[model samples]
Structures are given as structure tokens and as C-alpha cells.
Target chain A: MSEEVMTPETSQKVTKAPTKKVTKRDLFWAWLKWTTAVEVPVSFDRMQALAFSFSLNKILRKVYKDQPEELEAAMARHVQMFNTNCDWGSIIHGITISLEEQRAMGNEEVTPEIINSLKIGLMGPLAGIGDSVDQGIVATIPLAIFVPMALKGSILAAFIPGLIYIAWSYGWSWFLFNKGYSLGKSSVLSILHSGAIKKVIDIASIVGLYMIGCLSAAYVKFPIALQFKNSNSTVNVQKILDGMLPDLLPFALVLGMYFFIVKKGPHYLGIIIATMVLAIALTFLGIM
Target chain B: MLFKAFLVGIIYWLSMGRTAYFVSFAFRKPVVLGVFIGLVFGDVQKGLLYGATIQLLYMGGIEAGGNIPSDQGLAACIAIPAALMSNLNPSAAVALAVPFGVLGVMLNNVRRTFNSFYTTYSDKLVKEHKYRTLSYFSFLIPWATNFVLYFTPVFVATYFGSGLVKAFINAIPTWAMDGLANAGNMLPALGFALTLVVMGKKQYIPFFALGFYMYAVMGFSMLTGAVFAVCFAMISSLFKQHDDDEEDYA
Candidate 1:
């Protein structure tokens, strides 16, 4: 049994247990191994809690080899309801590990209550931030760039964006995990509070919206081949629409679909089915 | 075909809900699945074309708040294989894929509900200090559950349904197939519309208009439009930051 070192000034109890040996390499490896598994079998009950415990399995085993009660406590702490952005959520894992390790080392300040509260409190904000960045920005940028290419039948468009996103997300998550481990809990808040998070979200939303618009014009091809015969000259409806505005039908169809999907509140399947029926009817009647 | 379907079903299960990071990315999207299906059918180009067309139908289906509105991967797997086996046009394949996507949503819900039982068991295991067993409950059990859910339907459909589908396609009139193809062409508008619904707000409608005009009227390429959109995003963000700073000083 190693003696506990109490630092009065920092209020951090350092446990000098000889068996407790979790290196930085171990934390990184755990993150790589467990990031995806964290969401597998994610339930409404515990969310990612079980997977979190699994990720910290090795560290917990080493840190509390002699302290069975504490080991049990640590496992139970992580099994509570936890949900957050899957990739960015690894920061929580890193921070929790640090706290658990310290607690095992005789840090009375890092209680189960504190750890649980920190996790519950931080997850929502981190999810908000992570969703905005990962889904809104990181995911969207590559998607926006490659989607049009894919639409044009370019194979590279399909593979490149996904690969880049995977690589970028992997690197981003690894970096955040290390940061959380090194900075502990308090400094994580300072990083979040810096206002850059807001800026990223704002910029991402703008770009995402604009690119979608571009996608609608470039890819959505809805043409009405109907024309009216006039006394002097035959009028082409599609040509007239083209003269008035390029891709007018596509634009309107997109907006109508948007309104129907968002406000009309039919399930996506219903709308898809309805569109098929309407399309078939229109094509048969030569009205499309 | 049965072997391929089993593999695709497994791919769908792994990519959507199972463990493994990069593997999921490779198969989750229809475009990738299209390539795989094409490889299976010995027609990579047609598969790519079909997959891309189907992929457009789901370009906006972002998984938000953990609710996947449609299962594009499953749709691609089922649709591409069926279309290839039947010699149907890619456009008709998009329409054909929709039902499978809906069914996938239902199955996904069931999978989620069933997995909840494991969470309870995990709680008991932790209490019992059965630490090692947690990994099995967390990873393996859910995986097996997903494998069973996905593989069964796909295998049955592939083994028994292919000849029936080919006969059915052979029996259908040319006009009906054309109608279906037309419907498929029009369906993409719904996807684009859905994208706007998710990402567009009234305030940001101008950017949508800007993107549309730049491409539709100015005849700018998609790449060019993207560049302009990026520039606009940067400018707007900078101006907004300046305004916030001014408010702070005030």
C-alpha cells in the first residue's frame, strides 16, 4: 500500500498506488478502440454509459486492483445515463478517467457525486458544441464539396469526403481526449467559454445552408415539357420558364417539398410515395 | 446472390449500429454501397450511377438527435441489387428503394428497443462486480442482435426473391416502367426540399437564393457556387463578430 500525498494548496489528493499505472498511450489507445463502440447498442436508459465503462475497463482494472469497492463504485458511476456527440464526447471519457484515477489515489474531493454531476452537466453543452461542429461544419463542408461531384457521376466525390471526414474526426477526437486528460475539468469550461464555439456554429450554418441551395439548383432537375399552341406561334412552357428563370420548376418543387415535409407533417415515406404516384400519373398524362 | 445479400446486410448492420469506426463510413452511404453492389453484380459503372442517383434521395437525411428518418444504406443495398438483377433503369431503382428505407426505420426502432434490455443487465453486472462480462454485454450482444435482424431479411430476399423479382419486372409493361422512372427523376426534388427544411431558416433564405441564382442564372459550376458560398459565410461571420464586439463595448 502506497501512501497518499495530500497537497493542501491545490486541494488535489494524489494517490501513489504502485499498481495504478495508466500511461498517455493507454488513454489514446482506449479512445481509438472504444469511440465507435460507445454508441453501439445505445439505449434510452443508459445511453453510452456501458460503453464508457468498457472503454475504461483496463484503466479501472489497474487503478483499483486492490480496492474492489472503489472499482465497483467507478464502474457504477459510468453506467448512468450519458449521451453526447459521439466523436467529441471522448473528452468526457478522458476527464472522467483523470478524476477516477485521482479518486482511486485517495482524492476525497473527486467524489462519485461530483463526477456524475460533471458528466451530466457537461454532456449537454458539449453535445450542442459537438453537433454544431461535427454535423454542422466538419461533416457538411466535405459533403457540400463532394455531393455535386457525385451527382455528376464522379466516383472520387463519394470516397474522398467520407475518408477525409473520418480522418479529420479521428484526429479531432484524439486531440480533445488528450486535452481533457491534461487540462482536467476546470480548464475545459474555460475553453468552452471562449466564444469561438459560437462563431464556428454560426459560420457553419451559413455555409451549410448556402451549399444546400447550390445543390438544389445543380442536381434537382424537374422540367415541365408541356407547351401551349398559340394562334401566331407555338409556345414552349419549359423554354418560357427558362427565359423567366432557370430551374424555376425545380426551385418551386424544392420549396413545396420543404413546406410539405416541415409544416404539412407527413412522414417522409408518405411524401415519397405520394411523389411517385403523382410522377407516374403526370408522365402518363404527358403533363410533366 | 444470397451470399452477397448476407454480406450487404452485415455491412448495413455494422455501419449503422455496430462497432468499428472507419468501416461504417465506407458502407453507410449509398454511393459506397453502390460500388460494392456493382462489384457483386459485375457492373461497377451501372452500380455507381444507380447508387449516386439513390444517394441524391438521401443527401439531406442527416441523423440529428439520434433519429434516422431513413436508412439510406439499407435502401441502396436492397434497391441496387434488385435493379441490377431486374435490368431496371437507375431512376426506377430510386423509387423502388423507398419502401425498404421505411421498413428499415421500423426494424431500427425494434433493435433499439430490444437493446434496452441489455442496459438493465449491465446495471446488474456492475453491481455484482462482474467487470469483465460488461464488454460482452456492451459489444457482442448488440452485434449479434443486429446481425440477426439484418441478415435474415436480406438472405431470404436474395435467395428466394430474385427470380420472382426478375419475372415481375419482365411482366411489367414498358409504359409503367417509364412512369416509374419519371417518378424517380421527380423524387430528387423532395430530397433537396428536405435539405432546405433541415438547414434553411427564413433569415438564411437569401443564401439559398444566392446559391440558386449563382448556379441557375449565372451558370456557375457547383464548385464555383461553393466557393462563393464559403466567401459569403466568412464575410457574414466576420460582420456578426464585429457587431457583437460593438455591443460588448456599448
Candidate 2:
């Protein structure tokens, strides 16, 4: 815990120019430390990134202020380190520095447009990646396995999901952190454009989309109470069509709820409450 | 009330990761917490199973943006202890757990407001930044507040009269207990739908469909579903790669 907790060195040492030392253990611990029990997704071991960014910025800021012949080269070097280890959060952090510059230039008012853009723009991609990797795959996959075991009376079951989630989520963080710092932006973007990255994304999309569909089928409820009579035409309401469909009903219900939420936003909580109340009432009525 | 509840809450939080993790505290996985409370109160299996089931019923079901009031923490820390100690139906335990946990959330906010209340006194210290004293005061309020509020009640609940508690809950008919268990089991299913909405997308739709179909049709367990999914994805990926190679030439 002492090793993992944000030490003062992480924040302050970077303010003063420091040597760039990267280690595999540093990357490993950075991921493992941040992931211990807390479910704060999208935190990029920022202290580590912060320290690294500080050194790069301190050197670059000096060079840029001097506007030397090697200014572009210096900026390129810093940018290279950044691009290699660059994550979406670090980009935003870098952008924050840019905004501060804009402010210092005497542009007093922050534009509503910039705020809106950050919200509507950054949120979608963050939610997409977070939901896909964080909640959907990492959380869902492990919990899916470990939960039943917990139900089956295993004290050790809870740790299973905890372990798996910390491993995958933090592992990705460490990998990306080191990669971005080492590779720099140009190479990473070039890699992204070079077909290898696209293939990975494509593969991810295929698997990710399929898992979402499966989640939809497994989770959503259609409530397809049939109104039709049986072969005797005796006013029997539970018709054959109710159970015949594999996932059509379930899939539709989740989509319907999603659309409802889209249309109404947080009001759906009320709907859930109402449904729960009605369900309880029906149970009382013997019609559930 | 404060001191006992604090002890209970501490035990509850520590139980979340079963002391595996120390940062920001979370051992809310029901099975682990349940057994801990059970052993502390003396019924190993009941506490384990009770805690775990309550945990499952709300698996990954987060109420983001403050829309739904869920008592996952209370369900883990408080409800299992209350239920197991009282010899109440496990299902009844879950139902009661939610409201209690919600109560805890509400209480937590009130305590937060009290800390805000203490902020009014900060003006005198601000001139010097009284940096060391200010920092100490900040810790003292929350620690003192939570300690006094939770510790005693929890101690009382754990130490005495769990079976005496059974009598009060037993007044509710067995039919009601059955209904609660039925309802509680079904509650987990309700969350799966929301989780699906967040997770589903066009690119990987087939594997999920395949997984669900295998579960519904072939009667596979989640483990089997996961295994089949990995197998299907790998095989399909190979074929897809081959298809792309053919298309490259054509």
C-alpha cells in the first residue's frame, strides 16, 4: 500500500526537471497500485503520467521559451515521449495546459462551445471504451464466472472477480502508458493508420458487438404476455408465441428501454419504480 | 449507535475485498461479507450464502447519475448480518437490505453536510493556512462523526439477541417469505437487461447471440457460454481472415 499510494515524489519531483527513467516494474506497479479495490475507471495512473509529463513539459517549456534552433527537435522529442505513452486522459491533460496558455494570453472568457464539445464529444468515446472494456468485458466476464461460485458457497469467489478485473484493467493501463511514452505520437498514429491497429479495432468491434448482443438477450425482459387462446379457443391467454422466440422479445425490450431512456433520460427510474410496485401488486393479486 | 455502527461499517468495508485491497475500501461481495458476519455471529454457511445471493441479485447493477437508489453497500454490510442474526428468510433479508442501505446513503449525505457545517469555522485558520492544524481538523471531523454514529449500534446488534430478533420477523407469514424469495431471485434478471443495453453493439452481436442461444437452447451455464464464445470467436476470426485474403485477390 505504501508503495502504491501517491507519494509526494510523484507530484513534486516532476516540477523540477528530472531524469527520464522507465522500468517494467514501474509500469507494472503503476497499474497494480491504482487498481487496488476502487472501481474508478479511466484513471491513467495520472500521478505517474503527471510526473512524466512534468519533466517533458519543463524541458520543452524551457526550450520553447528560448525558441532555439533545436526547438522543433526538442518539441518533437517531448511529443515523441508523449505519443508513445499517450492515453486519451493524458491528451486531455495536455489540452488543459493548452487552455491555460489560451487564458494567460488574455482571452478572458472560456467559450461555452469548448465546454459543450468536451462534454458531448469526449464523453461518448470515454463511455464507449469504458463501457466496452471496463464494465462490459472486464467487469462482466469475471463477475459472470465468479458470482455463481459465490452463490455456490465459496468464500474465495469474490476475490476471483477482483483479481481478474484488476489484472485486465490495470494491465491495459500499464501497457498503454509505457507504449505511449516510448513510441510517441507519430509512430502510434502511423501504427494506427498502418492497418495493424485497424485490424485490432475491427476484431474488437466484432467481439464487442457480439458480446453486447448476448448481454442484451441475457439481460433484457420483453414481458411478451400472449393474449391469444389455445387450440380449444377457450380464452387461454398464455399462447404458444410467448415462449417460441429465442431472443427477439428480450432484445426488443432492452432496445425499447434504451430508447425510452434516450427520450426521457433519468425519468426511467420512476418507470422502474412503477413497474416494481405493479409487479408486487400483481403478485398479491395472484396474476404474476 | 455511532460507535457500534462504525465498527460494523469498518468490518463491512474491509470485507469487500476481504482485505485483499486497502485503497478506498470495498469488500461488498456478499458471499465473503456474509460468512464473516455469520462467523462473527456464529453460523458460517448461512452468512456466506446469504451475503453472496444478495450480492448476485444486484450484480454490476449500478444506478448512475443518481437515478436509482440502490443499497448494495447496506445489502452487504448490514442486511446479511441483520438477516442471518435474526434467522429471517434470505429473500426477506434482501428486500429489507435495500431500504436499509438506502438509509445509509441518506445518512452518509447528512454526515457530509455536517462536515460542510464545520467549514464555517475555517475562516480563523485560513489566514495562516494553519496548514498542519487544518489538515488534522479535516481528518478529525469525519473520523469522529462516523465513529460515534455507527460503532455502538453495530456492536449491540452483533453481540446480543439475534434469535430474539427472529421472533419479530417470523410474525410475517411464510407465504410472504416465499414471495420475497421469488421476487428477490427475479430482481437479478431485471438488471441484466440494463447491462445488456450498455454493452450491446453491431460489431460483436453474433457471438453474444450465439452465447445466449447456447444457454437457452443447448442449456449451457455461463462458464460454458464463455468457453463456447471464445471458441466461436477464434474459429470465426480465422475464417474472416481467410475471406479477406480471398477478397484481396479478387
Candidate 3:
């Protein structure tokens, strides 16, 4: 394997300007609480709006202490239409809170419209990237590789994906949040410009596809029991297929099912019933 | 039945609440649920086997964008106990879990619809500037909604439905049981099919072919296949980088 693991180009220079009253310690506490309880009160109406506001609750309170009307407005802005891929989306939360802090400290340039626009604008793009990388690759790869072992009755194997997931999700989320908080608005530009995140995903996907292939060959079993008697040779059809290409039946079965699912619409129940019927019919014919 | 009912209810409620991540990570899996149910019923090994078996049926079920294709958690919660009480093997348990998962999906829709009412109420609270009472709508109302949605059905089913399931299992003919087992055997293809649908791209066909042939023809282990894949990824990445360098100069 290649030894190169390219890290994202995160800007190191920390800008010290328009320092706010809300301490970093307080923000840290809220962020920590949010990590454990982000989806606690998840509802369809606000989606993750409640949790988003809840995380910034302390900062909001301190920033708008003297101005009750401003505090109410801030709270109201957070409770609006808000949902995103939670792990990567936490960075947006960090940026939003930092901007809010600056605005509350009477930064004339940082208006309420800018803050709302920032949240709304970033949510969609971030969600798209997060879903493709986090859900599509990171989550899928581990399950594909480890689930086979788990099915084979290894307790330790079953635990691997869950452990890896918790660590990966929390670790990246924490780093992104810190980066966004310290770097403020510029962090967004740096993250986008680096181009390293996309490369990493592309490479991971190559491995993901390969692993899915491995899973199919090993796990998706379709052992044929057909036989033929010709002259002195009583030939087993399954053995002939295996000699030419191992797991041919399983491979064909998977491809057939894949076409059915993708083209015929992904009604899993219908596919299952169809498979059951096929299995029973083949068994009845003594050919499977 | 009463004890199992209470347990299932608690697990279901947690799957939708604050500790949702934990529930999703550890408890929601059919394998884990089986072990827990087995411990409760004094048959840990049986539970483990059944749980693992049923888990394969729902292996492809993933919740993306809050849309649950199938409710594996609910399926596991109900199926494990039902299988345990009825003395049905894991394959039949899978056949049983399918409908429960479907029912759970419908209930999920109902929960989301019900939660919309609270969303409207939240809007009202925000307009009124009742910041203090906002927690009532966000935290209290939705939390309560999940409790009602999840807890009631699980509790009632465990208490009353187990006996009926046992009778149903008793009535199933031997050939039908064999048919169910055969279906169970074929189910993993659907799982792989689902994963393929998500990850499939024409450009990646070579990698898929390499993986399949490496394992099937060369008789390589899964670990070996992964290692080979990584090597190929690295090699391809380097070649691409070389091409980029050439383009930059040109």
C-alpha cells in the first residue's frame, strides 16, 4: 500500500480581533454537551433546530444578557428550518455561534441576515458532501468488511464497526468544530479549497467497491445441486461451474437481483417474496 | 412476556431519544438484541444464533436522510422474543421479522406526522418570545411522542402476541419450514444487491471484478482482497498524480 496519507491544508495562523465576552470554556462545554445529546429531542417539525439552539444556549445567554429582544430574535433564528448531516454539520454550528458572538459584541458588519444566510447556504452543500463521504463510504465500508465476520459468530467482529463509527464520527466532528470556531468564516474557504477531502473519499470508494465485491463472493451463496450422467462420467454441474469460475451462481444471483432492484424499483419485500418463490421452485425441481 | 415487553419498550424509546446514537451503535443490532433476550429468557446461546440469523435478512436496511428503508431495530426487538417463546429457528424468525419491520416503518410515518403538530406549536412559542417554554416543545413534546409511538405497541405485542406466534409456528408444515429456511439462505443476495445499487458505477467495475475473482478464483481471504485493493488504489492514485503533473507542465 502507498504510504501517502494527505492531510487537509488547515490554516495555522489564528487571528485575534473583535474578541467577545463569551469565554471559549463556555463554548467548549456547550459543544461537548451537544456531542452526546445533539439528537435528543429530535422532531420532524424543527428537525435538529432545537438541538442547534440548545448547543448555543449558553453563548446566546451571555452575548445578549442586556438585550432581551436580541436574545429572543437569536433564539428564533436558530429554531427555524435547520437540518444537516450531524457530524460534518457541527462545523456549521461552530461557525454560526462564533459569528453570533461577534455580532452580539456589536460588530456592525456581521448582521442577522449574514448569519442566517451563512447557516442556510452551507447546510445543503455540507449535507451533500457529508452524506456521500460519511454515509456512502465511511459507514458502508466497515459494515461490508466486518459484517461477514460477525455473521460467522465472532462477537468481537460485530463490535468493530460500532466502535470505529463512534470514534470516526466524534473525532472528525470535534476537529472540524474547533477549526471552524478558531478560524471563523475563513475556515470554510480553506476547507473547500484544500481539495484533499474529495481525494480521500475517491480513494476510499475504490477500496469500498472492492470490499463489496469480496463480500458478494464469500457470503452470497447459491450452491447448485444439478447433475448429469453421460457415458461413464456422472458429472456434477456445480463442480464444473466452480472449476471454471467459483461462485458463478451467487454472482449471477446477485446481478439478477441487482437489476431487479434498480430497474424494477427497490421494493425489498417484493424482491424477497420473488426470491422465496424461486428458491422453492428450484428445490422442487431438485436443481438447487 | 411482561418482562420482555417492558425491555423492548425501553429499547425502542431510546432508539428515538437523546441516547439515540448509543441505541443505534450497540443495542439496535439483531445480534445484540438476541443475546440480551437470551439472557432474560435463560437461553443466551439460542438468542445469539437466532439474532445473528435474523440480522442477515435486514443487513441492507440503512436509515439515510431520516428515511428508514426498513426498521431493523423494531424487527429485532419483536422478533427475538417471538422466536424465543415459540421455539422457532432463526430462519422462520426472519420470515416473521419482515412484516414487523414493515409495520414499524408505517408507525415511523405516523410519529413524524404527529411530531409536525409540535413543530407548529414551536413556531407559536418563538413568535410569542416564550424562550423559557421553548424547551417544552423541543425536548418534552417529541420525547413524549416517541415514548407513545414505540412503547405502546411493543408492550402490547410482547404481552399478548407471543402466544399467538407460538400457535402459528406450531401450525406451519415441515415443507413450509424448509421453504422458509431456503428463503433465508437466499436473502443475503438482496443485501449485496442493495449495497451494489448504492456504490455501483461503471468506472469501478474493474475493482469489483478484481475483488470477486481474487476471492472466488484465486481463493484469497477477505483480508487479502482488501490488501490487494488498497495496493491498487495507491497505484492508481500515483499514476493520476503523475498525469496531473504532466498536465500542469503542458
- The most accurate candidate by DockQ is 1
**Candidate 2 lDDT tens digits, A213-245:** 454444443342324446766542334444566
Candidate 1 deviation (Cα RMSD): 4.5
DockQ values of all predictions: 0.45, 0.22, 0.38
Error of 1 at B214 (Å): 3.1
Q: What is the C-alpha local distance difference test score of candidate 1?
A: 0.72
Error of 2 at A182 (Å): 4.4
Candidate 3 residue-wise lDDT, B1-250, digit = tens: 5776887777766654434353354456676676677777788777777777777665544444455556767887788888888887677888777657667767776876776676667668877867667766665567777788888887787889888878877787655665555665666677666655555344665776677767776767656777887887777777554222211100
Worst 10 residues of 3 chain B by lDDT: B241-250
Worst lDDT window (10 residues) for model 1 chain A? A9-18
- Candidate 3 i-RMS: 5.3
Model 3 root-mean-square deviation? 7.2
Instruction: Compute the lDDT of residue A197 as modeled in candidate 3.
Output: 54
lDDT of 2 at A129: 41
Comparing 1 and 2 on TM-score, the stronger one: 1
Give every prediction's interface RMSD. Answer: 4.6, 8.8, 5.3
Q: Residue A132 CA error for candidate 3 (Å)?
A: 4.7
Task: Order the candidates by TM-score, highest first.
Answer: 1, 3, 2
* CA-lDDT, candidates in order: 0.72, 0.46, 0.68
What's the distance in Å from true for residue A29, model 2?
A: 9.8
Worst 10 residues of 2 chain B by lDDT: B16-25
Categorize the docking of model 3. acceptable
